[model samples]
Target: MAKEGDGADSIVAATITDDAPTKAISSQGMESINATATAMTKAKNAIVVVEEACTSSKKPEEPKNPKTQVLIVPLRWMSLGMTRAKQQLVLLLAMRLRTVKTQMMTSKLQEVKAEADEKLKSISGENVLLQINCKALKNENAKLFKGYDDLEAKYTSMKALVKEKIKAAKSQAEAFKIELEATKGTNAESISKVAELLKSPPGFFKKQVKEYTTMVSTHILLVAKYLYPRIELEAIGEGYADGTSEEQALKLINDINGVATSIFNESLDL
Candidate 1:
C-alpha cells in the first residue's frame, strides 16, 4: 500500500513539473477545459477526504485485538493509496486531452494551407493562359491594321488614275467634235456613223461591264463566307426584320462591320 501511494505521488509530481504551453482556444475548447478542471477539483476533494479518514484512523483508540488493528491499518492505507492514484489519473487524462486537441488543430491548419496553395496555382495557370491569348490577339490586330492601310493607299492611287483617264478622254472627245464639224460636208455618212458609235457603247464594252459585275459579286460572297462561317447570309438580313430587339440589331450591325473590315484588310494583304 505504501509503494502504490509513492508511485502515484511520483507520477503526479512529474505531470505537474512539465511545462504546459499556453494557447488561445475557442469557446468549445474552453468548455472542455472547464469540465476537466471541475473533474480535477472533485478528485482533489476526494483525496482530501481519504487523507482525513486515514489521519483520524491513526489517532489513539480503545484497546482492540492485534489482528483487528492489523486489518484496519492495511485497509485504511489501501484506500488512501487508491484515492491518490485516482486523483493523479484524472490529472493525467486532462493533460492528454489538451495534447490531442492541439495536434488536431495543427493538422487542420496544415490541410487548409495546402488547399489554399492548390487554388492559387490554378488561378495563376488560368491567368497565364489569358495573357497568352491577349498577346496573340494584339499581334493579329497589328497585322490587320497594316493590311488595311496598304489597301487604302492602293484604292487612293486607283481613284486618282481613273480621274486622270476620264479628264484625258473628255479633252480628246471635245477636240474630235470640233474637227468633225469641219469635215461633215465632205464625209456625212462617216460622221453620222461616228456619232451613233459615240451615242451607244460597243457590245464588247457591255460584255466587259457584265463580267466585272459578276466578279464583284463573287468576291463579296467569298468575303461573307470568310467572316461568318456556318451562318446563312439571308439570316443576317432577317435580324433587322420586325420584332427584333434593338440590342440584337446593334450586335448584328457590329458583326457586319467587323466582317467588312476584315475583308478589306485581307484584300490589302493580297
Candidate 2:
C-alpha cells in the first residue's frame, strides 16, 4: 500500500510537470500573438503616416483667369493709331466740304456782280439815248428857225407885190366905170353887141384871181412844213432807232405824236 500511494503521488507530480510545460508553451503562443499584433499595428501606423504625408504634400492650386488666356492682346498704341486714322479721315472730309462751300459763295458773288454790271451798262445806254435825243432836237430847232425866216422873207415880198398891184388897179377904176357906161348906149347890131360884151371887164375878176393864187400858196406851204418834219423823223428812226421791240416802239409812237402836236400849234401862228 505504500508503494501504490507513492506511485499515485508521482503520477500527480508528472501531470503537474506536463501541465507546467503546456502552460509555458501556451504563454509563448500568447506572447507571439501579442508581438504579431504590435508589428501589424506599426505597419498600419506607417501606412497612415505615408497617406497623410502624401495628402499634406499636395497644395491647393490657384484658379485660372479666363482673361489671361489670350496669347497676344492689342496694345494701346495700336488702338491710338486706329483712332488717329479715323480723325484724319474726318478732317479730310471737313476740309472738302469747306472748300465746296467757299466755291459756292464765290460763284454766287460773281453772279451778283455780273447782274449789277449788266444793269449799269443798260442805264448807261439809256443816258446815251437821252443825250442823242437832245442833240437831235437841237439840230431840228435850227433847221425850223431857218425855214421860218425864209417863209417870212417870201411873205413880205409877196405882200409888197400885192400892195403895188392894188395901188395900180385903183388908178384904172374910173376908166372901168366909163367903159361900162359906153357899153349901155350902143345901138345893138348883133356883131357890134358881141364886141361890146367881149371888151367889158367883170366886176369881181381881179379880187377873185388874187384869192385863188393865195390859197394855192398857203396849201403848198402847209404841205412842205409837214413833209419836212416827217422826213426828219423817218431819217432819225432809220439810222438810230432800236429795233421795233414792243416797249421801245410804244415809247417812240408816243413821242412822235407829242412832237407832231407841238409842230401843228407852232404852224398855226405861222
Query: What would the per-residue lDDT of candidate 1 be over residues 1-270, giving only the tens digit for each residue?
Result: 233434435545644554541232446555654665455344433333333333454533422434223212222344354544333334444455445556767999999999999999999999999999999999999999999999999999999999999999999999999996675444345547966765588788767766654565456776678977886778654556788875575556445766665655565465
Candidate 1: count of backbone clashes, pairs at least 3 residues apart or interchain = 0
On a 0 to 100 scale, what is the lDDT of residue 49 in model 1?
A: 33
Clashing pairs in 2: none
Evaluated against the true structure, the overall lDDT of model 1 is 0.58
Tens-digit lDDT track of model 2 for 208-253: 6556545644554566667785555445436555566655654554
Query: Could you tell me the C-alpha RMSD of candidate 2 in Å?
Result: 44.7
What TM-score would every model get versus the actual structure? 0.38, 0.27
Please report, as a residue range, the 10-residue window in candidate 1 with the lowest summed lDDT.
67-76
Q: Please tell me which predicted candidate would have the highest lDDT against the true structure.
A: 1
